[model samples]
Target chain A: MKFSATTALAGSLALVLGFAAPAFADIKIGATISETGPASFLGDPEAKTLKMLVEEINAAGGVNGEKLELVVYDDGGDPNKARTFATRLVEDDEVVAVIGGTTTGTSMAIIPVLGDAEVPFISLAGAVEIIDPVKPFVFKTPHTDRMACAKIFEDMKKNGITKIGLISGSDGFGASMHKQCLAIIGEYGIEVLADETYGPTDADMTPQLTNIKGKDGIQAVLNPGFGQGPAIVTRNYAQLAVGLPLYQSHGVASDGFIELAGAQAAEGVKLPGTALLVAGLLPENDPQRAVVVAYKEAYEKATGKPVSTFGGYAHDALRILVDAIKRAGSAEPSAIRDAIEGTSGLVGTTGTVTMSATDHLGLDLSAFRMLKIEDGGWKIVE
Target chain B: MIMRLSSKATTLLILAAVIAIAPFFFPSSYYFRVGSLIFVNGLAVTGLVILIGYAGQISLGHAGFAGIGAYACALAPIHLGLHPALAAILGALLSAAIAFLVGRPILRLKGYYLAVASLGFGILVSMVLSNEAQLTGGPDGMAVPELGLRAVLKAVGIDLSNTEFWYAFSGLALVLGAWLALNLYHSPTGRALRALHGSEVAARTVGVDVAHYKLVAFVISAIYASVSGSLLALQNKFITPDVAGFMHSIEMVTMAVLGGAGSVLGAILGAAILTTLPQVLTVFQEYEQLMLGLVMMLVMIFMREGLLPSVAHRIRGRGE
Candidate 1:
């Protein structure tokens, strides 16, 4: 036993030395994405996008003469692990910027860690609070849930729909969007006739949709959540034939949702999504068309999978950081943070990002494009 | 027969040696993060050692206590103007009280029935934490105030980095928790609880108060989970309802059972393995859950009594 213990100790020392040797100075960026767990649908693409972009940047003469080194860790959708990895990235990896917290919970978990470490974190998640009480070192590329609510409501108003029913998930993303939807319903002159919620793992949301269907004067149904919940809701809505038009949040902006819900069930469902989803269909005169098209083409060609807004978040985050790093002319975390905050009118895959002292998200309602699922593909509605 | 130290002394000695020596193998502060994670989990598993190991009671929802403890650290300081440390204490107290109140009625059920009841309680707690957006931040989670112990240490000329500080702090907490648990194992109450674990009817016939002892174990374990949760929230400076979610509760149980729920050392061993294994598996990324499930299945199949006990049994081999 003693002999084995000594041998194990010696082996660990050798391993540590092996890791310590030949550390080159590279422009290191870190990411904690939910690559293999519940949020993997968001993270797998985001990780691939980040990896592809880092390679492309390095291949294209690096980030201003320094090779981009991305240190990616799969957080498994756990906040605790996200916090740990965030700390590791800042203190151990010494990364100047981080760019992928694949879920709202994981994103929020790392906010203080990166804020204190003074490393700039560009979150890919869409929770409004991630940037609401803006931490100086934190920014995100995705439009907030509040913005999604606004965009959906604006579209509903244009369609002469005023009375709506809400069915949100009981998870963090769902609850946050639900709150925002409630808070802003009055502003949109929309009455919430039925407000119901289901668990994240609920196999059926027909009961809730059934409740919404029974509500008098309900012009539409709005279900706000990511992952399997919205898909299940869509399937059940179609199964139950609720007949009311279903509006989903930007949470289900991915093609995965359409596939999961089945084409017929997901048909005609409207959502607010980033331009990445409709890059192929965008007109030549659109401001975001070029960048969106570039990212979508590069990403799809590299991964052989369709472009997703989740990946767009990572793409936009890295691009924003590179832009900031070029302007700042230093790899220092503090300088990168300030440069990122000072960003103005930088077109990203998501939208025109304009960061300031108070607004770290740098996205307005225009960042969202009203999209509908047509023939199992996304189509621009307006 | 070979002479051996008392179980309590052996457990403490092992814990001290492991905590003191493990840092030598740590490659970076990243390892410290993994270490602190293991200790926090170890602390919670140690609490389960009392309820599940000694009393032979199962709690599938102890993470509910952990959630309460974590949210307390996040909310109390913000709402009531208390220091973060004091809020942790308050969270622990609240967890203990809730455990006692809930345990009284639920402890009467046994086996799968008890499991279902505890599971319901956990689900309800997570639901409230998620649904009550006004207080709990409605799923985006709320930030915990800093504990400020590092500042105090800095003033005293004992500066330590955040990762280093949490690693030491949580390690010390685990040691303290293990010591208390070890001491309890030697107490007469411990004997009564163990007796009830052996056979509740037989224990009742022998004049042991089964309900009272079960409640005591439940409350004690709940306090353990609460403290562990507080430590986690204070360290990460964030709290989510997932802390109290059914998954976390299942993780606590799995850690205890996988290590040897009957032994404090075993429980800690279980926590250490489960906590560290995931961090190591983060490299593989895609194979994490598959690998974890395979490891768990192999352990259960080969070593029915858990890792430590089964390994120790093999070493002792036909002795005793």
Candidate 2:
């Protein structure tokens, strides 16, 4: 097609000038998600869930008699762009609360910007550092890697497993979880007999698995990674006939992992995951059962896609933020922030949240349910 | 000669006026942040103009220098006990030294060979930054200390908002970068660089050390990229290894080429357009990438000489 410089210039000019902020008496909630890049699997559903919740909330006559205006910017998983968007959300959109930061990098990048602005930010990323020291304005909804490690070790302790081989992807999530697990393994009376790591894009993990399998006293194997790495490890474990129970981190708490690793190979694999992964399996009286079931149904029906734990993080974040905003009795940033901090006994998808000044995540080990892959689906194991 | 001097002065004047006056029209402080980002990118692209436009040497891994600069800012304050401002200088010096060393060998290669060699260097830097989780925070990245100049300015009764402070600081940096680059354009070394760019053999016969001039341009450009990275790290107070990623190096080159690689003003305009395009296109949401690609494609098709130079050529054509 023939193109003209004048046309391109005029088009760009129109786009730049086309942004006209509408007058809104509603509360503005902002988000900066990694909506379109390498982290899109996490951020796409997150953006969808946030948009769906905002619609649902507004449809129910909004929060505190005011409609919610969600200003979401796609950062394309770039931390620098995420920082810019976080600043824009606070300084330009003037949002009372933000519910994003899809990746750990983006979360850390956005944290200081929101902290400086004193705008309450509930990140969806699963990183312990996001709230370890506990920034005043930063909160997260997902269970952290540390919590995941503790949950896995608790299961192993119950099983009377004393020694295990540790294999992790050298990516951010795996490395952090590996460190967290090692730090607390001594408390669990478990010895990591063999610890190994594979590169993120390593097509074959057989060498690492072989090395771990050769350890004499290893009772089980644990893979702490997300994406296809754990699936590859799982397959290699089965191929090598390791004859040991394999544990995976919450990073791969999805059906896709089973499908990728093959259902047969994935059978008997255990991991700590959110209740959203087993919404139908929860007992009727469980507090999270209703919330998770409702979110799963709504998300599935709206997007025609299966509900993921990633989206559940966004669901819990929005619900918590909106609930806090409602209880705060004001849309003031500091008020919303304090309300988020004081959030207690709030039942949501990730589990009942009870945030304190010292604990911004508000989720304990109970937030992660130990589930075994059985019959090609998740089976709640405790 | 007068015409050449006037053109240089005009470029600087236009750039300065835009930096000084654009904030007045900004709807919010967010625009100041975006403007500062453009200037930061412009500083780096100005440097590329020296390497690619002046010396005709292609570097596909200049972002490696940028990574060093950014990490230097993040690591220096805690490890070396240097102030953030001084850390930026340390970063620039380190980048220059690395560039000189790397350029010495790799600058011997021509065209695509050099491009691939530089690209490997960039990937190697990013791999280290990503793998060294203990120091660089791995892929999650590390927080950068504040430049702390704003507090000093406030103490002197000239307080500016964080975004405004960065906007003014980065704008001044860009102007200085452009001034230095324009000065180099007319200098004997720059002439030698340009002469080599035109014909290496002819320039060599005319006593122009082709290899030395190329190395000089490469080192200078690397310093510009490093300083740009340091400014970005300081202003945002956060950074990830993505600064040194291959895509960023491509972006620097794209900004220079798309705006008119041969001219400092043109390259800065390219940087401004590219940086602002993403911000403006975010309104497209899902279609943002499609629209961005389409715009860049169209610009490349129609403005073969790049956005600024082609338009300038048309204006000059009309003047006749």
Candidate 3:
């Protein structure tokens, strides 16, 4: 035991020295992700994707002839730890740019640290506040809850569903989406007939589903939630036979949701999801098809895990940062920030992202493809 | 009496020296942030030492008070138009009052009963903080207003960086917190609490007023936790519901017990170890949790009494 302990210590000392060795002009990119906690479902893939992408990039003669050095710290879904890691990334590692904030809380905690340091940060979390009243140095990759709502409402309008019943989880993602949907339901000429919510740990959402189902003249039902809450709601919705076309938010745009909700119950459910979810279904002429397919294939091949929309967010973030570095022709923080802001027509797994001075999240409602679950698989709804 | 006085001064002196001199050894400003976090945690653990180590009481929900304190800084500055400093005081007072009320009934229960009741209290606070989205920003958390003390210092020509200011401020708070706790160790109230801890029945027979002493310890600890929470919120400039979650309460107790809950210096050492361990262990990447768990298990197994106390015991044994 003592021998192994000494060996481990020596190994770590060597690793530290390797890291501390004078860089050969490598462009350092730091990330703080919740790789092993409550938010690990989102972050585990993100960390993997970042590692795989950096290795692939380095192997392909690196970015701008400089190797991309990646520094990642697992925040374990703790905001305090996230803040500390953000500080370390900015002050200690002195990274040119940062990516990865796996949850809204962690992203919010990191924003101030990165903003103060003037380091260009690309967050993976899906919160509107991260960009709204935007900080000069902060950006995000995931489509916001507001955009998800807008996409869902647009689809509902195309289907001629005027009035809908709303069921949402009281958790962060669910509550935020619920509020965003309510705010813009008027814009799409949709009115919510019944609105209900379930707690994060609520075993059965039957009571809430029943309340929504009881509402008259409701053309469809929209359940906006993440985790098992949505799965439970879907199960209850199927059991109740609400009959209206059921729509879910982009929160559960994974195969895991279908397995949890059962194939039959989730069969006809439609949700706003990224191109990565339906990469195989895209047309040959589509701009994002190549990008999404390449990412999906590479990610699955490397990790032996199915590609997720969450991982795609990190993929887009890293791609955008690299593209920005290439365009900037420099590794300076401010130059990178400006170059990121001026990003245009950069095809990524998410979409053909075109960031501007005013917009940090370049993806629009079009970036989300309306996908319906059919035969226990994702089918793109044209 | 002189020995006791010098011992108290010695602990304070050592803590102050560590806080002041540690900065010189820091490779970067990140260490300052980590150091400040350790001090904030140390303040809270010192309170737990009083409650669990001296008073022989356990609380698994002290983070509830911390959440109250943190949210107070976030909300009061905006809603009530109070200064951030005053908001911190209000948070501490509110925690003390709530602890007084909640401790009365729950402190009557012994052992696991007290722990469970306190755990429920913490869960209830976090639930309120999370559920009240409009007021508290829900689980996404809310940004806290600046404490403005740095600005005050700047006006007086003392311009430290944000991390440096927080390090000095929180370190000072920890020193004050430790001084008070060490003083309490030798006070009349401390003896009553310790007497009850040894044997409540015997203490009652000897006129210790067991209930009053327990309540006193609980309130004091709650205040300590509240102050610690305020410092965290002010330094981060953002507050989340997780600050008041069950995990945070467990972390506070763990830090106290893992250091030597019996001594002020020992508890601080525990806080330092836990805080720095996570930061240092991040280099292990995916193996971070495994490494953290292994380190903790090894420490508990080897030391048994905690890092500082066990080391001190070894040194004394060698001397003998």
Candidate 4:
């Protein structure tokens, strides 16, 4: 059981040599995902979708005759890893564009890296800050927290719900959505009767829900956060029998949320989600329906897992980048960046995407569709 | 390897050799980023070494100081109009003051009580950072103003790439920090701290001013963590409350213990191993955490004193 420094050093030496960047290919796209951490629910699918999409695109005679290659690294939800991998994707892999960042923090971590390198980075995480200040080389496919808030509020107004209670996790995603939801609540003339917060790892949210339920004149409850927190809140809310409309952020838009919260607990819950969730429910007239249906089918077939909104984000990012590459007629980073910014009316899994010099994330509030959980399935609410 | 060199000389040599040869081995900027990360973590853990190694005081919330240091860089330029460098100093002073104030009362408690108190301190700082949306940018985290030190260096005809600059800059900081710590180890104050660490009652009877020495160690370690945090924020140009989170504090302590918290070089070696291990394990993806746990467990079980100390002991012909 003696410690051997030489053996340990050799092991690490082999690790470094083994992972030395492989040969570069034409039309390279790189991605960093949280494939095995707190955000792995999002990253696992994101990695799969990127791998599957690249294979499909290359199989279809590549993008304009140049084979598309993907270089992916799992960031494990660590900002440091995201920064390092992002820099490597540009400097070592020499990718034309990068897509990834499964969490708001990791996505934001890569902003300065990609901005300084002047390479296009399409973030899959939700956060207005990712693109609000509008870093030149950064973009995202998912609707921002602001857009999610607006969509949920509009739905709330339609349902004649004005007074509501809010509970959010104290983590990065939850706190950001809480702020956005609060900022726009006044616009919809909705009054937040009770605003409560819970820690990300809190085992029970019943105290917060109980306080909200005790509040007078509260017609609905909104919880904004990703992972187990939202599921915990949903369970607690249903257990308390808080006879109010329950709303969630797009963060918990995946089927995993329902499974975690239990179908009975999640029933009648409304949230803003990407079109991919209820792709089968969309009518033929919807432009995104076909794209969603195709992506979901291919993703489920490729990975043998149910499609998640996170993967759709990556899928939309790749399609957007490929469209820009086609329009720019070059695989150069600068050209691809400009072409991506100038992108207009490209059909995507999320919705029809339009890019401009100012708006890095091209999707509008329309990108988010109001979905309700009914009978253990997502039903699009028209 | 077992040649008669002083530990200080050994530490300096290792630091110099790593700083000099790491760049040659770097395949790209990626390794530089990882290298900078190691130095940053090493810098923080070096501070912990002074407290845990010399003073025998355990802190489970030192990363809170790092959080303070990081947000100082992020917010000071915008709010106070202070330069980033000055902001880092401000952060260090602030961390020192807070640690001193908190240490005064909590340091009286022994073992688990002190650990709990420090853990609470860290949670409180992170909670404030996460809750104070207007100032700390809530949890989405605010952008840090560029330190622009590399640009300044470039103007002086010492142009280095971004990754290269961070790697060298952080490496220099770690070297400086380690130099100070090593010098302190031989000083009268360090002797007093170690006396208290061995037995506070015995040191008190010997007129060692037990509480004062412990506070000094705590404050000094807090400053070290703060400076490290500031460096990380400046390099990454991003700051999150997670820098001060419970897990980060655990990582800092784990790095110190894993390397041999008792020695400056050992602490740094621990930081390097843990930081590099995760990066290298990225290739394994799914098995990353499993392997990391296994390595940590194996090391703790076999090399009880940690990687460097145990290996050094063996090399020096010590008992198995």
Q: Is the docking of candidate 3 incorrect, acceptable, medium or high quality?
A: medium
lDDT of 3 at B2: 97
Worst 10 residues of 1 chain B by lDDT: B1-10
Task: Single out the weakest 10-residue window by summed lDDT for candidate 1 chain A.
Answer: A1-10
DockQ for every prediction shown: 0.39, 0.50, 0.49, 0.39
lDDT of 4 by residue, A101-133 (tens): 888889888988888889999999877778888
Per-residue CA lDDT of candidate 2, range B1-320, in tens?
89999999999999999889787767678778888999999999999999999988899999999999999999999999999989999999999999899888877766666688889989999989998989999888898998889999999999999999999999999999999999999999989999999998899899987778889998999999999999999987988999999999999998998988999999988898788777766666667667767767887899877788889999999999
Question: Chain A vs. true chain A, TM-score per candidate?
Answer: 0.86, 0.92, 0.93, 0.88
Instruction: Put the candidates in lDDT order, highest first.
Output: 3, 2, 4, 1
TM-score of chain A of 4: 0.88
Clash-forming residue pairs, model 4: none
Best by lDDT: 3
Candidate number with the higher DockQ (3 or 4): 3
Give a tens-digit lDDT track for model 1, residues B120-196. 88899998998888899766688888899999999999999888899999999999999999888778899999999
In model 1, which runs have C-alpha deviations exceeding 4 angstroms? Answer: A1-23, A152-175, A181-249, A252-271, A371-382, B1-7, B21-27, B109-112, B313-320
Off by over 4 Å in 3: A1-23, A201-214, B298-302
TM-scores of the candidates are 0.85, 0.95, 0.95, 0.87
lDDT of 2 by residue, A1-382 (tens): 0121233345446643653432357798899998888899899999999999988888888889888888888998899999999988888768888888998899999998888888899999877889988789899988877788899999999999999999999888788889988988898999998889998899999998999888898999999997899999999999999999999988888878889999989989999988988899999988889898999999999999999888888988998988898999999999999999999999888888999989998877888899999989999998
Model 1 lDDT per residue over A262-312, tens place:
999999999998887788789899999999898888888998988877788
lDDT of 3: 0.90
